[model samples]
Target: MTKFTLYLAMAISLIAGKVSAQDTTFELKVKLIANKIDAITKEEKEALKVEIEEVNKQLEAGTITKAQADEKKLQLAETRSKNIETRVGQAQEELKDLVKQKVDGKLKEDYRRKFSITFWDGGPKDDEGYKKYRDSINNNRSERRTTSQFVFAAGVNNLVTNKAVAGSDYRYWGSHFYEWGFTSNTRLMKNNNLLHLKCGMSVMYNNLRPTDNRYFVTNGSQTNLETAPMNLRDSRFRNVYVTAPVHLEFDFTKTQTNAEGKRLFRSHESVRFGIGGYAGFRVKSKQILKYSEDGHNVTVKEKGGFNTEDFIYGVSTYIGYGETSLYLKYDLNPLFKDNAVKQNNISLGIRFDLN
Candidate 1:
């Protein structure tokens, strides 16, 4: 049985064992009626907890979403709550019978044991053995070396110039980037959280805005940011990529011992740092130019090859506590194909290890 039920039964047993035959009948009726309510409440609560735990397992297994689990739990709580009130009313009727039996000296003092044992729902499936079995299974979950979480990051986007990660020729605040993906982190050492290998597939959207009224231009196999012929209100360039990233992460979270004395190592519970890189092909590129023409606003979107590198590779790193981290990445490959002065892409951002 659950701790709540056991403690209650113990208290009632103590009181009942000490009560004398000289005790008033009215006092005995009140004690027995209240104990009946407590016993009923405990049984309903235990059953409801079992149902909700199953829903949570389904959510973690990806069989149902979090919303569904919440809904199921709410429904079970409401049902059990109503059932408690209804059953308490029925137990009150038993009090009336007990009153009549007591007047005739037929209400046996041994009836306390009946209430105590009945609180278990009366079997191996519903007693202390069942609770112990469930607890053992929980503490001895199947061994798993890998776990997964959703990842998303966003921040300013610019290029490294002369080894500095700054937007030298581009608008610093206007350029930005966003990354969203799923990652799996695998433990490298048995019963340890110090090191892990993190790998993932991500889609990246990197944007750049040139300063001094400039926009990207393509000439044959060359691409450069050139001064626009028209005074532009906005000039922006965007690149998209599907990249696979791998990182060697060091997690400093302490390993904890469960009730069964087994060690449990979980990720993202403390300070963590990761150093790794990504490699992938540029999926697409585009340029946007917005200006006023003859007192009317005009927006132009140009989609082309732009002579940007088809394949790209980059170095990235992050360091922080738990779910939030400072993220930085710099592309090692040249931005354009065979340029005399190669320009590389760089980005600084905030990442969320959203599970």
Candidate 2:
């Protein structure tokens, strides 16, 4: 038999043992009555527990005579027993009526559905084996990792190559890029609950604004950093890439679950860290110019090779408490090809992971 069925059988056997002196009919009735009483609500279950404790305290303190304590215990048992009997009687009456209809060949599909045997419909009631089983189920659920098919993160983006010219001082907020992506995590090292491998596609948008009113201009395959026609309010060199990121994540947070057995999102309360890298081809590149142009105003968007390498590769790491963390990434390849300055891309920002 399945584990659940075995537990049910054992529970019935134990209940039968309690009434060994009674006749077979009486024992059967007791088993049915036990099933009904087991359906009590959680609050009622707590109340029952409190009642027992109160009686024990009263007996030890001599607040009530032994006879009185005995009477109180008897009253509690009698009340619950009556409740069980009442429920069983109503159910048995319904069953008899249905049997009569079935015997008469008058049973319908609707009637069949209405005739299910539900001893405890509210929730699972406490029994020796059943309570343990429920706790085990909850514990197993908490150990299971939660997975999200899509994750998003954004923060400061920059170029790190050529540290002399690629310092944070040269990076401005307007020029700071943002990165966000969608990925799926698969549990790795089943024996090691903390380890997981995440792989997914992400889009990186890197914006570069020179300290001076300057932008990038392409001359053939080479890009020249030159001054703009006007003192620009905002100038950005944007690179778009479709990349695949892979990370090995190690989580130090305690996993938890709800009654439904779904993993709870607790990124905020736990420590999570990941190390990984990404490689992808650049899909597009452009330079945006926003400055006062004539009286009618002017906006320029230049799209071309921009001297940037078509393919990109990068290494990144993130650490944080909960879902939000400090993220750092550095490109392994130069930002531009056949250029005097061999600048590499670097970004620092906050990333929020949905796992």
Candidate 3:
């Protein structure tokens, strides 16, 4: 009974020692990884600052020409890229080591009793464990991805119509106008080659003019005849609307290497095509009409009072390159519902992504 007790004490002491050693190693590994990551981050920042300062000095001293400065910029970019790659590799290795240690410790605790052993020999091999750990680290990095963007656009619209005449002659008249809207694109999708979706809301102001024409009228008896020409003037319309648009953009372009030998995906140059629809609600509307004969401005007729419906629906098609997207939209509803004005509103404009 004494010998048996002595053997059990020895086994317990060995197991306790092994556990203490593993715990210390695990803590030390964690500290080392943290310290290394901090060191790498500080080094990367300092290197970037130094590079920028050197470029500025070169530009100020004229020792390096503009072209040479550009070349040096490329070099600095490559250096930064390489530094990032190195840091990622180091992080991956450190994580692999930490994971291996943990797995080995757990395996030993769980499997040691069954096999009459103090440590697990069946823990993941070094290479396989490293790969698994690196994958986990990459997953964490992917979760941190973010992007920013910006956009701007302007457009023109014209109206064509004829004068209202009873018996005389009909003439063609039209007016040209313009509108502008600015918005920034906030990116909502991220995979390098996948279709990206973005949405933005913008405030647009438009100025519209309606063309006018005049007709002659002859009224008389058999002995007397009189002719008079009536002067017609155009009406200018101004309105502000809030527009919201959603885009599903696809980038179909080849990745190219820049002068610095870094792979850059050129945007805006990508043959980007998107189909989107916009909904705009009128905020304010006013009409300014000019009488040609009287040479005075007059208030023209308006449809849909302020308390009524003030919304416009438009479906747009976008086909263009890069940051500039060419768009064509047709208003779904007529501008005036009560009037028999056989006219449709159409617009051609450029869309920009600002983020």
lDDT against the true structure, each candidate:
0.73, 0.61, 0.49
- In the range 39-82, model 2's lDDT, one tens digit per residue, is 53234556666887899899999899989998998887666545
Q: Runs in model 1 with CA error above 4 Å?
A: 1-143, 165-167
**What is the alpha-carbon lDDT for the whole of candidate 3?**
0.49
Q: Residue 296 of model 3: what lDDT?
A: 58
Best by lDDT: 1
Query: Candidate 3 residues 88-141, lDDT tens each?
Result: 457746654444445445434443234322122545435576556544543443
Question: What is the Cα-based lDDT of residue 245 in candidate 2?
Answer: 91
Please tell me which predicted candidate would have the highest TM-score against the true structure. Answer: 1
What's the true lDDT of residue 307 in model 3? Answer: 28
Error of 3 at 248 (Å): 1.5
Tens digits of per-residue lDDT, candidate 1, 188-208, equal 999677999999987788999
True-structure RMSD for candidate 3: 30.3
Candidate order by lDDT, decreasing, is: 1, 2, 3
* lDDT of model 2, residue 265: 31
lDDT of 1 at 347: 85
Task: Tell me each candidate's TM-score.
Answer: 0.60, 0.55, 0.41
TM-score of model 2 (CA atoms):
0.55
